[model samples]
Every structure is written in C-alpha cells, then in structure tokens.
Target: MRKKLFRATVLMVVPFFASLLIRLLYVTNKKVFHAPKSVGSEPIIFACWHGELLMLPYLYFQYRKTPNAKVLISSHFDGLLISKTIEYFGLETIAGSTNRNAAKVLIQGIRALKDGYDIGITPDGPKGPRHEVADGIVIMAKKTKAKIALFNVKPTKFWQLNSWDKFIIPKPFGTLHYYSTSEIDVSEMDIEEAKLLIKEGLLKHEA
Candidate 1:
C-alpha cells in the first residue's frame, strides 16, 4: 500500500513539476539548432547520450513535436518518473533496458517505426559507460530501414549531477545548444560501422 501510494503521488506530482520546469527554463533560455528544419521533420530514430536527457523532451517539444513519438525507457524507478514526465509532453514510453529485455524493446521499437511513430533512444543509458554506443540502436535501424539522427544538448551554464551519466540541469536562464547530424543511412553499413558512425555524430561537437 505504501509503495502504491508513493508511486501514485510521484506520477501525479513529477509530471506537473517537470513540465513546468521545462517550459520555464526553455522560454527564458536562448537556443541554437545545428541542423535545418528538414532534419527535424524526418521520422528517423533520435539518438543521444544519457547525460543530455535533462532537456531533451522540452527540446523535442520545441522543435520536433511529433505527437506519435515513443521513447525507450528502462523499467526502473527513475524510468517511471521520466516516463510520466515525457508522457505529459505527448511522447509515449517503452519500458525496458539495454541490459534486460533488450530484444523485446528492439522489437517494440521496430514495430513503432513501422507504424510511423518516431522513436527516441539513449544508446548509452539505463546505467551507462558514459557515451558508449550500444549496437541495439544500430540493429533496430537496420531492421526497420530507418535512418539514425544523432543529437547532443549543451548548456552554457548548468548543474551536473554526480550520477553515472553526470546528468545536467540547465540554470534558470542560459544558452542551450542542440546539435544534430544528418540522417545516417544504415542500409549499407553493418551494425558495428553504424554504431561507430552514430558515436561520431553524437560526439562531434563535444569539447
């Protein structure tokens, strides 16, 4: 009973506060996008590092705004909060992790793609070795014949958490830059090559 109540309260309160914070910070902050509008329009797989997830949902809402998008999330306690938060912004969640139920999640992602729902994934997530690229994302793209778009969010001023990903929280008013690479065609490349390409695209602007 206690666990259920706690979960219910978190679901209700977290989304409201998360959405409010995202909107407030976004409006007050200046934003820069590296790619053109067309890149944002494509329904390809959106890939980013786990550390940069703090402002990603808001960034997607601001730029992509795909109502049918579904994000890959782990089936952990933290994932529960994040799933609820992103759902508030109209993005669905697939609860599973790379280390567990990976095949199931990949299948779900493929199906979502086939159904024309945009897919978002953090390749190095749900307990990460930092920004290392996992092959699951590449394989999903290969199976679905969907292109991959690598992105990174950098804030001029922010707080970095002590977590594995070193999660970031942008200061109330700061410059946020969203960088993305051109859609990567995975048809020709094998999984390993695709992984390398995505890693490069995501880390290209990192100093």
Candidate 2:
C-alpha cells in the first residue's frame, strides 16, 4: 500500500516538472519557424512522427496561440505522463492508441474535429515500428472531412535515444528548424492511399 501510494505520487509530480524542463530547454534554444500559409480558421489534423513528439506541443502553441487542440495519446503509463505534460501547455489529450482503445480514439477524435478542436496524432506511436502511418489517422480524417497537416522539426544539435522511435532531445542552445506541410485533404482517398500519402509526407524530410 505504501509503495503504491509513492508510485502514484511520483506519476502526478513528474509531468509537472518535465513540462517545466521542456520549456526551459525550448526558451534557451534558437527557434526558426518555416510555416506555410495558414490552413485558415477551420480545425485540421496535425500529424508527425512519434520521434518528433517532444517539442511539438510547444510548436503547436506557437502556431495557434488560442489553442483548441487535443492530442491522441495511449491509455498506458507513458501516455499518462505525456498527456499530463502537454496539458501544462494547455493542450487536452484523447486517451487511446492505434493498438489499444482504438475505438475510443476514432470516436473522440471525430467528435473533437466536428466541435472545432484540432487533433494531433503521432502516426506510429505509443509502441512504434517507427515512422509508419497508422490507419486510425486516415479513418478519422475521412469521417470528419478534416484536412491533415504534416509537421517536422530538425535540431542542429541533439541526442538520439536508442528507443524504438530513436527519440530526439534537442540540446539546449542549439537551433530548432521547424517545417510544416500545407493542409492535406484525405477525405476522398481510400484508406491505403491516404496512409501512403501521410507516410510519404512525413518522411519527405527525413534523413
């Protein structure tokens, strides 16, 4: 019982500090935004590789200061940490993954879109065979008739973890070069076609 209480306490406290640390790193780093023309006022889908997830919440906030956005996250422990961390940046979270709670993701994702909330998803996330586009993203876009935006950030100096996604941590004081694609409409494409487009768009700038 004591151990469980300590573990619960750790979960609640870590995300708060983690978010602060992320902000610290970002504020010290040089940021270059190479954004395209705005996708206008309509809610749109945002997709990126899972490896690029760390700095994206901050980027999203820079793009849409009056944010009405929610990120799709897994229902597992790490996802809880990520969900709470991004919440510090005023982003809500939808608890689901491509592998677990998938139906919940589809339902909540479409609902969020129809209600004018932008949704962010890491296509091959929460257990990735890295850099692959999952079907859930395609399904959600089709259901809501929303456009998808592909995003990527390249850091001048960073540490790459050996994790499945080879997660990146931009070293403080280095430059972060950001890029985003124009809104992509997958509403008319069949599932396989849409997934291919998404995967290609995301990997276009990959090293």
Candidate 3:
C-alpha cells in the first residue's frame, strides 16, 4: 500500500514539474524553424531521434493548433512519466513499443492515423543503441500510407544526459536550428528501402 501510494504521488507530481521545466526551457530558447508549412498536417508521423525528443512538444504546438497529436511511448514506467508530461501540452499518448507487444503498437498507430491524429515517434526510443532507427515506424507508415514529417534539431547550447539516447535539454536563451522533411511517402517502397530512406532523413541534421 505504501509503495502504491508513493508511485501514485510521483506520477501526479513529476509530470507537472517536468512539463514546467520543458516550458521554461522552451520559452527561453530562440528557435528557428526551417520546416515546410506542410509538415504538421493531419495523419502524419512526426519522426525524430530519441535524443532530440525534448523540445518537440513545443515544435508540434508551434505548427499545429488542434492539439490532436498522440505520441508513441513505451509501456515502461519511464514512458509513463513521459506520457503524463506531454499530456500537459495537450498531446495524447499511446503506450507500447516495437520490442514489446509490437503488434498492438502497429494496430493502434494505424487506427490513430485513420482517425486523423498526427503521431510523434522516436523511432529508436523507449531504449536505444543511440541514433539507430528501428523498422516499426517504417512498417507503420507503409501499412497506413501516412506521410512522415521527419525532423532534427541543432541546438547552440544544451546539456546531454548520460542515458542510452543521450537525451538533451536545451539551455535557456540559446538558439535551436530546426529542420524537417516536408513529407515522406513509404507506401510503395519495400520495407527495407523505406526504412533506410527514413533512417537517412532523420540522421541528416545529426552531428
């Protein structure tokens, strides 16, 4: 009973603090958008590397006003923290990952696309051999024929975490150079071809 109560308190309190921190960092950062206007349309997949996931809620909100986005997060406890934190930004969460209950993840993603929700996916997330792209995102795009908005960020100042994805937190008052592909259609390509194409697009802005 004590453990359950502690977990509940963390869940309730941490996301509010985390979201506050993100908002603080975001408002202090000078962001440059190098993305096409068509990137955040409905039914699109917003793909980015796991390390660059920090400031993306701000990125999404900058372009999209409907607040109809859902992010693919792992079913782990850490993912739960993220799920709750992003909810503060008016984004929904889908809990599952490529390595665990992958079928459910794919199905739910396709369903969300059909319903016109743009999905935020960190292709190598929930765990990572950092910067590596996984195949699940490619499969989801092909299966649903959803266009992908692949993006990257170059921050002039930031702190990098020691986690597997080398998660970053952009320092206050710094500039963020943001770049994104207009749209990528993987419906006609073979799985491997599509996967490699996306992998390249995502890594383009990485140092």
lDDT of each: 0.84, 0.88, 0.85
Q: Over the stretch 124-186, how does candidate 1's per-residue lDDT look in tens digits?
A: 988888889887898888887888877789999889999999998888778999877777888
**Which digits, one per residue and each the tens of the lDDT, describe model 3 over residues 91-111?**
998999877898999899989
* Candidate with the greatest lDDT versus the true structure: 2
Off by over 4 Å in 3: none
Q: How accurate is candidate 1 locally (lDDT)?
A: 0.84
Model 3: how far residue 61 lies from native, Å: 2.1
Give every collision pair in model 1: none
* Residue lDDT tens for model 2, 1-207: 997798688789999999988888898899998888587678999999989899997667656978789899988888888988888888999998877888878899999999999999999998988987889999999999999989998889899999999999889999988888888999999999999999998888878
Error of 1 at 187 (Å): 2.1
Q: lDDT for model 3, on a 0 to 1 scale?
A: 0.85
Cα-based TM-score, every candidate: 0.94, 0.96, 0.95
Candidate 3: clashing pairs of residues? none
Deviation of model 2 at 135, angstroms: 0.2
Q: How many backbone clashes does candidate 2 have?
A: 0
Who wins the TM-score comparison? 2
